[model samples]
Target: MTDYAIGDLQGCHAEFVELLERIDFAPARDRLWLAGDLVNRGPDSLACLREVRALGNAAFTILGNHDLHLLAVARGGARLNRKDTLDDILAAPDREALLDWLQSRPLLVRQAFDAGGDTVMVHAGLLPQWSADEAAGLAGEVEARLGSERSGAFLEQMYGNEPACWQASLDGIDRLRVIVNVLTRMRFIDADGCLDFSAKEGLDSAPAGFAPWFRYPRRDDLRLVFGHWAALQGRAEGARVRAEATDTGCVWGGNLTALNLDTGERIGVSSHLRR
Candidate 1:
């Protein structure tokens, strides 16, 4: 019963399947932890959805920025960008079922055992200020509503650029979007953990306003795994907390990576140039 956490799929269904086969994954025993962005901006977005959804309990997927964008567009609250690969999904007959399944997935995933300590997974990252307990509580609120009929209303409030800071008192869509961005889209943030969404450049060129979220002092208390920054290309340096950047830029012609949770071993399959 090996457990693996994979990098972003980004609609690369073929690679995803190949990686599983390479590892000889058994759905009944092995578990797959997805780092998020399971769809969009690549071929086979629909196929990815169908395949992962079929995995059922064997696959635990968190929501990525692209995944959330799909929900927003489906709810008519957001526009589909030019690079989006979600058209096939939005136009598919199983769109409703797919979206429902996606929304039902959590923003944070935790695994615990009697021997080993707890490990938590989030799509992107947790704020430096948040404890694991706080992250769990906040993510649960959104997940419950996302899996409910009120999900449409939640999607409506899911889009925006304001309230870039976290406040415990925040309610409604403003609060939800902030949490989603931090958990899914975050990469670099300021000392105050204010998100720096504008700078997508390489690490050395990060703008003056931001620092990597894991760099925040208090983050060392938690054992966490995250993705969402292809720019990092899977470079993580820390002591107590393991910041694993699994997105190898497969959508931009890189490999897809998977990590063995129990052994901390990493395996990757090439994107084969995506020609």
Candidate 2:
């Protein structure tokens, strides 16, 4: 009956399992909130996807940039990069089911707490211009098209960083692309709500015009939970929003983190890799 929010898996299946064990997670009773990137860059992409998919209703996962990239590559819209370890997933016997499950995941996850407020989880971060409600609506827009006939054409259009800001008037691929970026890859956002893609370090190293997303005015209206910034190592400021960055860089030999939703308690387990 407990809920735990986990950081990126990134194909580190062993660490993922160990973290579950450490937390004494029960697949039948405990619900897991995964912060995305369920596959890629580590030893067992297929295993990670299958394990999470096996959780059924017990797990709620969002789509990370890597997850979308896998979809694009599977649909023939993109090539497997040199560093990608996703071939096993693409070649698996249950590839269709796995891909379908992954594709069906939402871009935004909303859970109501007992204290009368709720938390919204996205893979990366939200734009300053968006309220949690607006962002959830926008996420549904991408979810609708991600696995449809239009996705083949839109997947190719999904790669760019152009139109780096969100606009109500944005139409077609431009709008979807911006939504995907902010939800999956954003780290810093300018005061005007423009995304900054260059820097990956912490807030102190922010580029001249940008600041971390949680620091923006009124961002605490809805509590935000996110992953994808390994540099943060499970730490994000802005207590008002309870902003939590759970990606502890397990794929890079750091630990995997899980947060207790009701208690706001965080626990970490080291990566299985000897690195």
Total clashing residue pairs per candidate? Answer: 0, 0
Q: Model 2: what TM-score? A: 0.95
lDDT value, residue 48 of candidate 2:
94
List the global CA lDDT of all models: 0.82, 0.87
**Top lDDT prediction, candidate number:** 2
| Candidate 2 lowest-lDDT run of ten | 235-244
lDDT of 1 by residue, 12-119 (tens): 999998999999999999999998899998898999999999999999899988898898889746888888989999999999899888878899988874433578
- Per-residue error for 242 in candidate 2, Å, reads 2.4
Roughly what TM-score does model 1 have, to 2 decimal places?
Answer: 0.93
* Candidate number of the best TM-score: 2
For model 2, which pairs clash?
A: none
The digit string of per-residue lDDT tens for model 2 on 235-266 reads 88653355878899999899999998888888
